[model samples]
Target chain A: MIVSLTHLDTPAALIDVPRMQRNIQRMQQRMDNLGVRLRPHIKTSKCLPTVRAQIDAGAQGVTVSTLKEAEHCFAAGIRDIFYAVAMAPGKLPQALALLREGCQLSILTDSLAGAQAIVDFGQQHDTNFDVWVEIDCDGHRSGLKEDDKALVQIARLLTRGGSSLCGVMTHAGSSYELDNQPALQALAEQERRVCVSAAQRIREAGLVCPQVSIGSTPTALSAQNLDGVTEVRAGVYVFFDLVMHNVGVCRRDELALSVLTTIIGHQPDKGWIITDAGWMAMSRDRGTQRQHRDYGYGQVCTEHGDWLEDLRFGAANQEHGIITLQNPASLDIVVRFPVGSRLRILPNHACATGAQFPHYHACEATGEVHIWSRLHGW
Target chain B: MIVSLTHLDTPAALIDVPRMQRNIQRMQQRMDNLGVRLRPHIKTSKCLPTVRAQIDAGAQGVTVSTLKEAEHCFAAGIRDIFYAVAMAPGKLPQALALLREGCQLSILTDSLAGAQAIVDFGQQHDTNFDVWVEIDCDGHRSGLKEDDKALVQIARLLTRGGSSLCGVMTHAGSSYELDNQPALQALAEQERRVCVSAAQRIREAGLVCPQVSIGSTPTALSAQNLDGVTEVRAGVYVFFDLVMHNVGVCRRDELALSVLTTIIGHQPDKGWIITDAGWMAMSRDRGTQRQHRDYGYGQVCTEHGDWLEDLRFGAANQEHGIITLQNPASLDIVVRFPVGSRLRILPNHACATGAQFPHYHACEATGEVHIWSRLHGW
Candidate 1:
């Protein structure tokens, strides 16, 4: 039984700080070479230190999924904030509060009613709000199609209703389902084209369309060229997970976020080593289930972070993780892992996993651990 | 748009207080009639107020999965807390800290090493620890099988190693898979039998085994008689979810936990009404996927808590939920839901979904909303 790091409670979220730094640098350098500014989405790591690291590495601004992220980031001195999800009308007062507090907040809309709500809110507040028209590149989730007439219509409403029609943005979120480089590159190009097309149409309609933003972690890394895209936004690259690894974007070793857990017991007859981390610690994200490799809940590794390739982390309860042999030939599971042994579990989705904890234990390569607080809810 | 609750943020965790009270009442009443102590597992809510409600309604003590939960509940004057997850040896100091602080903390161990560690720790501290031997009722997760020789061995280890062998406990978590009443009842009886048999074996070995505990929400609710069980422990009954609903344990209307979200945008042609509660808010728990009914992400309900049976919440990104018609197409999706309208999303697993937020907006049937903080992480 290893006594070192026993102080750390099992089922703790750990951030490999050096690996995270490498990931940030790699993404920033790629975006720099592509001639587009990187606005690292703060959704992946809601912790400010990671966002600050990205900002210091030349990330232009930050893209947030919730108002809580904007509030947390803004309070931490990040001025340029983009609320990436389409604006909800009821949230206008909150947005106005942020704007009044001098947050350069940009909101999104893809529908005529959505745009109208923003416009009406802006008029009601007697202030102009920065707005982006979301474009649909791959029909993944939200946004208007690239050729949708509502793009220009929404732009016109924003401009006429006293809100600034800042630009067009699209997230090729469907790129996550792709595993090949060619498919990723094609989707990246389409993502770029969609946003640029929407922006061009808006500008052609005599509205101010200054910025064109497009990305998803896969598209951002795979795009061969960024013809008209002004800024690239991507989350999850900072702490690439098993899902991203399966998508052929990041190497499995580059995964920075992992749940530090301890082997609590074992079902020796069943070749199962039970750990304290389960769906509660690793999260319920089955992001890699349909990929080339399906990491049931997460991938297991040794205390020093070496891959445990033969052991499969599978079938989790709330707090009990059942790790068993992939080949299942009856090794002494109890004697091998024993109790009190610690292991690092690479999550399927970093964002979901990180949210499971209130803070991350950032461990440096030199073995120093720092606790970084994370913003949780909206 | 209803402006009454517009002050509340979107994608918020909401607890319908009245419904929650009913759930607590239903479980407590059942346990009361079953002639066993109801040690409510606080893992579902992880909030003090809800646990206090359960206690106020006749629960004996609380069952916690993490030491953090134990610490929090203990601080709240909940003296008897069973740290139900098998004791991670490394967490012994933390658990010891709780025990030293006058908290009646009961820890569990299913393996020899686990029992040895607890015994060693107690011996080193010159104190006797309260220990529960976990029995594997069903072949789902952790614990030793009822017939396993380790049952008596571990019990003897604990009793001799300066620790009080409190009893044997088991959770028929596999009961979550059953959809019919007969299967649930069978699993419940099996769960009780396993715990009782293990305790009987330990007692036959002349060990001090005083209690027999067994449960899972489905089994706890379905058990015809508790025969030899001294106590029943179950969580997720406080806020029943779609998963429990699929298991035929709880009704759809009995679920107390729901995410309060706003319609943010739409893809009218695709018949998708987008909302702010995506996986980030509703959680990544697709617990209902393999069940009788698959609520894609969650079941959509009105702000007043009425179910929208036609709308299925499908395909979620980080911050956007796509709620669409079950029959596919034909609805004026945007007009029906609108951009500012509020809706409640019933989760697949209440425990998973409730953990997504730091606090729940506990809305009384009288329309008053109170924030109840939840304990997150280790």
Candidate 2:
């Protein structure tokens, strides 16, 4: 049964549940056939219910970017956790605490100093922690060169310090820069070669190098080969946003999350329709910068997730959004949407926009409604 | 005593607490002399401790953009709240609950339909609510023009519906568009005249306009005239950001919050330094779009908050940031910032960036530290 529409306070965030579920199932089924473990990145949905759904979808573990996410997931019975960002000495204490709480925690490090700091923390705590030396495959974010001597030196130092080395992990972050499938495939090969070579070098040094993690939603999904990779950490796959569509990672229909907003006012003379949603509600994520299309701020939607033709959020302030109608003279549809009419907005980056709101108002494809609470903060 | 610098997280959010205290005090003292109530907006900090500090600085009430923010402030002992966005019928039931819980909650609405919806919701819930008709002083966001018939109709409907008419409020969001102090002052007068005219029109229609609220940090701070404004609601004043400095609202010395990040790598050949902090860490707040000077992503700083010369964040990705040195050839001052060196980054828009992280590492202007947790979502 359809729930009666409640007047959502202006600037409230809305999530289409059925779309999210479909997106989740699509990824899970793909990974199931791939024969590698799927560790969905929790940073995408900070919501507990979404994570629970991922676990139910056969995800082997969850990857997070912050300690608070690790703590929240662990408290919610998620045991296998990988803190994907490089670890620091300040966070080691918290990581040790989580490990002692019977949680399997693995951290990434790209620098010798970072490795030394982790070793010092491990020594002081009298604990042997799992360490993953991050390798820079595409020169995207942070990672060591695949052939850098410092990688071996840091790994050897960790091993000498009684820390268990968990092999190497790298993210082909630059894959998002590719404009087509061929470039995507090239990035995938780069990812595989760097990760596989890093693993080989560590093993050649006579050490156990079993786990080699490599991921990026675009690279992971488009990769032609995953010969030596043991696990993939892909987030944003479950709720592909406008950025994904622009980068050739997914299509508009594949995007799951959207901001449900209401038309609050209209400037008929200017052909501007204002919504209750603004940067404060929709987040300031301009994910279209690297894409072929600029969906000015975000793509506007009709009630059922269809892109509203020619409508764009041309500009926004904290609580104000101005939509410019592509053709102000269009006679088929009303240019001035009356007050209280609801509209859905597709975000530029689902992760950043999703992080703004507290709960997800999940709705099935058939429009069945449920509430999902999201965890926030560190 | 200086705290020992160890391996803290690479990209962590830090706030200068002493400067924050001074910021609160200065705004509070200004409002006190103006003989108007200070309903400081919490959208900037979103932190309970920061809100408490505002209260301690003699703020009369709090203003928020979302119900989640109102709920957070209410739970923290803030009784008087103004939900400063246009309210909808679906969200009214929840607002009524706050009223039932003994909190003095007020909401803004700009249309007759919006007012009717709230009235219907109030009837359905059997609760009374305070309503304010939002007025448009300068075509910035959603609001009824002072001379528009819609304003009169909305006020009549709200007064006739058993809901308490708390008068009108307007935000001069365009004040941020001004490039000089004179333009800011002109915008302030325009805001004052528009709001006062709206209040007069309401009173002329045989209605009591009890509170006329008008605010924008620039207008509020530079306004030589606030003849009819009963209260001022400006949030970003407490933590002046780069946007404030760009608009001539405040100087850089007045900015109290910044992102604490670490230099993680260096591309000596490209004259680019990489930091763990990126768009995800500092948020995508490009507040200088309309300003005379575009400060790239944000202003760079040393650990003690001193502005660094010529170093600016040239490009950023979701998890990576590239800083370009002003002079590509200068290598005199130790060309490489050690991998573990910590740096502070000034924000573009304080409200948007502050919402990205969970808590603030509250540090004193003198460099002492504490932690303040932030609340999110409704």
Which tens-of-lDDT digit does each residue in A1-378 have in candidate 1?
112344877788989899999999999999999999999998999999999999999998899988889999899899999999888888888899999999999998888988888887787779899999888888888888877877788888888888887788989989989999999999998888878888888878777899999989999999999999899899999999988998899996688998999888877767888888888888888888899899888989998788889989877888889898865565666667879888988899999999989889888877778888898878
User: In candidate 2, how many Å is residue A293 off?
Assistant: 1.3
Write model 2 residue lDDT over A163-200, tens digit each, in one string: 89988998898876776998899888889898999989
Which residue runs of candidate 2 sit more than 4 Å off their true CA positions? A1-18, A28-35, A201-208, A329-336, A365-368, B1-12, B32-35, B55-58, B72-79, B119-129, B160-164, B204-207, B263-276, B315-336, B364-371
TM-score of each model's chain B: 0.97, 0.96
DockQ of each: 0.86, 0.43
- Candidate 1, residues B167-219, lDDT tens digits: the string is 99999988988999999888898898878988888888887799998888999
Worst 10 residues of 2 chain B by lDDT: B1-10
Where's the lowest-lDDT run of ten residues in candidate 1 chain B?
B1-10
- Listed for each candidate, the true contacts retained, as a fraction, are 0.97, 0.43
